[model samples]
Target: MCCAHKNENRGAFIVLEGTDRSGKTLQCQKIYDYLISIGRKCIKTEFPNRSTDVGKLLDGYLRKTIKLAPEVSHLLFTANRWELNDYIEKNLQNGVDVVCDRYSFSGIAYSSGAINLDYEWCKSKEQGLVSPDLVIFLDINLSLSSSRSGFGDEIYENIKDQNNVYEVYQSFSNYSFWNNIDASQDPDVSLKNC
Candidate 1:
């Protein structure tokens, strides 16, 4: 027989994945807040966190102010995640739940969306990073997603790129821990199921 308390100390690593304007940021905040309200130890983070040097490069690429080669940009994005790998692992090991706005999935989808890099090539850079225990993928149709505000700013924010990223996210369904949520529906109802 297993001890019921043995698993209590392993905090959940929850990752929110979605295309641009899919309300991932808001939902991550909501989930984080809800966890806190319930008195659970929680921490929230976002990729391209923009606080680290690697993240600064990613922010520049996203803003289109700096033009790095697609491959190089991809590496920088992966490096940004690597920069946080230790923190995330330690937090979870300490039983602090982590809610991430984006993760390796974003790295793969965004890079593949840009340079048409092989999926494996996009994924290889992220190997050995800790995987989220639960990945909540918010699915928003391209048509509906495009209609939302702030959809046309960055270098890779166009419909073509968004569609490609959506396809890439779909491939993640093979992972048993992935949960796909339809964001086109009411947020409250979606949250209930998420």
Candidate 2:
């Protein structure tokens, strides 16, 4: 079994993680819609939520309007997620499935991959958070992801950083809860795999 800590009475916590433009958002929506249509309680959410106070800083950083040291930026990202912990946990406990577009995995992979931060330290910050019941990683090729529309609009959207992040994500494939889906496939096919 996966190392995820789950309560049998709680709804599943599912996370979809991948590089920018790797269709995480889309798949999240698809999964949520499917669940809802089938009479399941589900909500779709994304990390670096860009709505909270910390998320506002992260949004500014991502939009190139502000600059921060790599470590600080990474912490800000983690804090942003922390801001949502209560909401996520409460929903799960209420039997509402949570479909998150990204989570701690992205934070660690992006920070470690993009700026060469210590992977262990990056992982360490994620302690004491709700673990996903299932993590679906959309595995898209860097070249194809880079060529997608609006690819270079944000940080870590380039090929080199993405390649690094992809490698880091690959390293997590051995975990039983982690599912890797080929992002290059048709949306229907990919959704089916998910």
- On the 0 to 100 scale, the lDDT of residue 3 in model 2 is 49
Whole-model lDDT per candidate: 0.87, 0.90
Q: Which stretches of candidate 1 lie over 4 Å from their true place?
A: 1-8
RMSD of 2: 1.5
Error (Å) of candidate 2 at residue 87 is 0.7
lDDT by residue for model 1 over 76-121, one digit each (tens)? 9899999999998889889999999999999899889756877789
lDDT score of residue 86 within candidate 2: 94
- Candidate 2 lDDT score relative to the true structure: 0.90
**Model 2 ranges with Cα > 4 A deviation:** 1-6
Q: In candidate 1, which residue pairs get closer than 3 Å at backbone N, Cα or C atoms, i.e. clash? A: none
Give model 2's TM-score versus the native structure: 0.96
Best by lDDT: 2
